[model samples]
Target chain A: MTRILADRAARLLDFLWSGWAGLAALALLFACWQAGHETWGDFILPDPLATLGATWSLAISSESRGLLLLTAQRALAGFTLAAFSGAVIGIIAGYAPAVMRLARPLLTVVLGVPPIAWIVLTMMWFGTSGATVAATILISATPVVFVAAAEGIASRDRGLGTMAEVFRYGALGRFWFIDLRQAAAPLFPALALALGTSFKVAVMAEMLANAGGVGGALARARAMLDVPQALAWVVLAVIALVVVEYGLIRPMQAEIEGWRRAAQPWGVKK
Target chain B: MSAALELHRIGHAYFGQSVLNSIDLQIAPGEVVALVGPSGSGKSTLAHIAAGLVEPREGRVTPGYARHAMIFQEPRLLPWATAAQNIGFALRRAKLPRRLRPARVAEAARLAELEPQDLAKYPVELSGGMRQRVAIARALAVRPDFIFFDEPFTALDVALKRRMQDLVIAAAEEAQFAALFITHDLVEALRIAHRIAVLDLRGRGIAGLRILPGDPGARDEATTFALRQRFLTEDPLFRHIHDVDERRRP
Candidate 1:
């Protein structure tokens, strides 16, 4: 019971600190915006306050909310598909040197081809539907996850293998409990990168394919010379990225990797 | 019963470098035998061979006992796991009832003199001595008939090393687990071992053996001092150890 309370208190403290960090980040962003505004004027880079106002307007519009939801679902679906497949395949490849060697060239090829190039092929296959956007997101994001997971698995401590043998952990028990725990921290940067990639690719795919979402709205804003609205949609997409990456992934990370916190010193060393 | 662990004519080499050659040894149940030698005498290789971690290139390693555990040079704890969880990890193969694991883990911690509060903390949170204690507890928790120590106390400070030596002697007394303790430190071998086997640095194997005078755990300071004096003055291996050091001078 006390442990439970301590956990909650730690989480609550993390959230509070994160909240403060977000505000500090926003303050820095505003300074950059102010500088950019002075050089380029409102035509190229609209006032930061104006972009916020435009974002507020989008938040209030029911149509915009639906578009937001659609884009978010596509990005999330792609990220989920990529994260699972990448982690599974990467782990399998990690164990089998032959598989890893074969997959290396394929991974490079897949990652090397730009997402923009894939959008045209996806459009031809999926006919500008949500499928096109999802496919684009997948092609663009999967290699990042795959590469990260493979490295994580490769870098795991071999000493633990002897420990596992001595302790009598079965193959499955070692994989699930020990091997996966060892891989957790290394997988984090990959998962985060894949997430950010999904959002960017989804938006790009939506713009090119003309699927209904904030991306379509962004396309219309671009056509009509509504710079603030275009910037507003970009802000909304970044907000969505932040929401999924932090609100969801980060909390799970805290739970899984909190032991690392104990290693950190609270004060400077003498 | 026969010896808990016996190695007959064990020989091994890496790429023909010949790390160990024609070694034979045995440990009876509840016996503490220390294998001591200079830096490159294959003490760890011998320990590993006895524990079945390494297959001897020649001869046989026979384990008469049902179970065995090892204390490595490093604590080798799972960094992500708490001390209790690390202990529990070792118990996974022991086939204990799921409901009873925590109690067993707690019992192991008590045996190792680990503080209950520290049990919940991860390896990174613990000091070196505490981590080593956790490793000791992990080895003891299995209640093995045989335990192999591969110079596990070398990293510890002098005081902590004595405490760990006492812990080993006490565990051997209470648990009756035969141990093949490996180290290069003559003083440490004398402190904890009933019998000390000296390994030949020149590949002759099993150079000599010495039986200390009294119970290892109960020996007085005077006895230890006298034993050291006798080793330095009379033991040919000890004389060679000193001579080897003298030979390295410019």
Candidate 2:
């Protein structure tokens, strides 16, 4: 139909606008990099061509691929543990005021401590393994999720809750229909932040622990004074972070938020 | 059958200040009763108590039927739920199987005159009138034996209000369920109520009760208007209350 064609056309226009904007931004970035490279010469700054060559070389190597996969595995494991435990503890704390009160001081203490402060203790406990690295990541991200979930539950509309009670919707039905739906919007942003924090903290923990992963490769490259290779690994890590964020976390968020999208703008038309 | 609802000297207070005192009322099955009073006169409080949302501190409220539902002053639809989903919430606890819920929801939506496209929309997406209709649909979906309306059409425009009033009358006629409708609008109260109960703000018991004589279906506008004037002036209590409300109006 004509309406469908118009909708498709509008979508295509939005896509083109996004693509052009990104291209313009990238061009500006490349110009800055080229100018910096020229001023500093080869030792302090590598040319774009040289950086790309180094990145390609690293990408094709079997050892680099294994290191990348290992780093990804550690991030996934730590993020999974944090998300599962955080959601369970958060829901319980949200619903029960007594439990929330009991846990408040402890949660504050845990959230305030720097990641470095816990790194030595984690290393002492787990002895320079992936487990220690993962523990540090989990400890760093769980509080964010807890706060969001708790606030969401606290502010639910009491009138709707009363309606639910009048309908004789038992505990489970009440939770699913009223409580969970109210909590989900706040929970998504917290989950996204936790996911991003997992990847960043995992890399930092791996580097500090001197574990066998991309961090170890970076450490070795630094020691050998292979600055270009070290920078290449950093670039690889950034790319991995972007990929994981967009590919994994974003899709999950979209799936969870589909209902919200369908709700759309209700009032006056713009 | 006994009266659909009975209130035995019901009284309520907040912070030692009495809102309702020694109230006694009874509504028969398939009857519509309108409770009209000034602001802060405890009309809404009585409705809430009758619907079992709030319990009175003193005396008993006995409903002849077990099932009851309410429509508040505001629509009070859940922001997160679609029109269909919100209506379905009222039937969520029903004894019907899962597959029958959609049909029941559809039936209520139809009764409320909700359009197909609007059914998939959220409360925020609808206009004030549309949202009010959804709220009405939700209450009807429960198939309650008793219904309470607390100024349910206050936010609507004149045409929409008339449409909603007709819908309420139509529903009551079809279902034969008892209703306690609270409103400050005399015209609205007269149009729908089988009997009108005027509350004395200074005292607790009903000041007066007027039983309307002709069938709503057969009555014309002039007859209804004349009846409204007769109730306002011929009844001594109504005359005093109307003068006081007019004096108090800013």
Candidate 3:
């Protein structure tokens, strides 16, 4: 038990140390943003500091904070729906080739249709509500997770399956312990991609449907030509994405992928 | 006396191509029987059939043992799990109480000669030999009366292979488990198996069986080498053991 705790503590420290690289990358991005602001002046692109000030003011106000919460809820709800259903269907399709064959064309059709079209359609179907935003996000994100999970299951090592069979693992037991565990390698990356898509589509649907969220706030800023406010809302949306990805997705990924880290020898760990 | 495992007219085919046909074999309790064959002789297929990993196209597998485990050609350890966890994986199937598992896992690890610190490491973090040790530990953890080894040490270097064979000999002797050890190497078969069964080139049947002079693990290296040389050079049953017919491999 002490060894496990110590290992977790070491991993936590390693995670914190890795944040320096992330900060360095963020600084580089900010430098490029500053360059663009200087090139275009205040009319086209606002300076990063001004945008930060606007973001801080917006974040401090109760009204804008509520809007942010609404958007986060919509994104999370839609993401949950997509993750669950897509993973189930994908896993089923993965095990059954006929179902996979059927799902392929359907996935192609769903992916081929643009997210803007879905947003427009969902707006008509669900009106200017959270449902519209959520439906749009689901339509846009489900296929990514579906494809990922399906491929993950399809490519699993059959040797492991045989090994499980030798141990007398039943169908459900093998699926739970071996197949699903193997599928997680590809599934996690797909989930991360799907999550990003969810948030993006959520905000886009909200803007188009006039739902009261950060996207609606951005639309208002656009109407008034408040570039700094618009940039602030964009920044807020990005911060929310980073928070969800790093806060939820990355920690879970780290826990599952520790073996991958162990594969790397000492003095070469990143 | 009842045999530990009995294969009566066991036959199997893949995609209508018969790979194993009308093979009959039996292992007494606490005996290590080595099954040696050419590359395409369906040795692994027969082992898989005996272990119940594959359904035979015909015939029955009557397993008289309480439980059985297998160690495959590759380590086949779950890469995501620690070495200890890999051993515990089999223990989970054994249905031992959850709290008692750690001790069982540690005991099996010790039997496999793995270091205490190595238990926490993943398969990829360990050396190739260590990875195979984890596989052996996994098989041993189940505490079965019967075990199947499908060329478990075929991938190891010469020295490592000998060590693993010795480990298996020690494990089987200590546990008194009946084993069907499949190998292409005659020396390996001689060193580890009490009796050697030569499989036919076309999987027609068990070609022949030879009982070695002394018990397994008691035979010296010089005797094993001499027996191996005699089998390869003089024994007609082993004439096709070293042959590689890729076209006929199932």
Interface RMSD, Å, model 1:
4.2
Off by over 4 Å in 2: A1-35, A38-62, A92-109, A262-270, B15-17, B199-208, B215-220, B233-250
Cα lDDT of model 1 by residue, A28-76, tens digit: 9999998999899999999899999999999999999899999999999
lDDT by residue (tens digit), candidate 3, B88-174 = 999887989999999999999999999998998788778999999999999989898999999999899999998998899899889
Off by over 4 Å in 3: A266-270, B248-250
TM-score per candidate: 0.90, 0.84, 0.97
Candidate closest to the true structure, highest DockQ = 3
Local accuracy of candidate 2 as per-residue lDDT tens digits, B82-110: 78989987886777678899888888888
Q: lDDT at A13 for candidate 3?
A: 92
A1-270 per-residue lDDT for model 2 (tens digits): 795476447645654666788799878987898899999987777877788789889999998989988888888788888888887788888888887898789898998899887777798999889998789878988888887787778677767777776677767887888888788888888888987888778778788888878888888887898878887887888778778876776656654554565455532221
DockQ class, candidate 3: medium
Rank the models by DockQ, top first. 3, 1, 2
Candidate 2 A-chain TM-score = 0.83
Pairs of residues clashing in candidate 2: A266-B125
Model 2's CAPRI class is acceptable
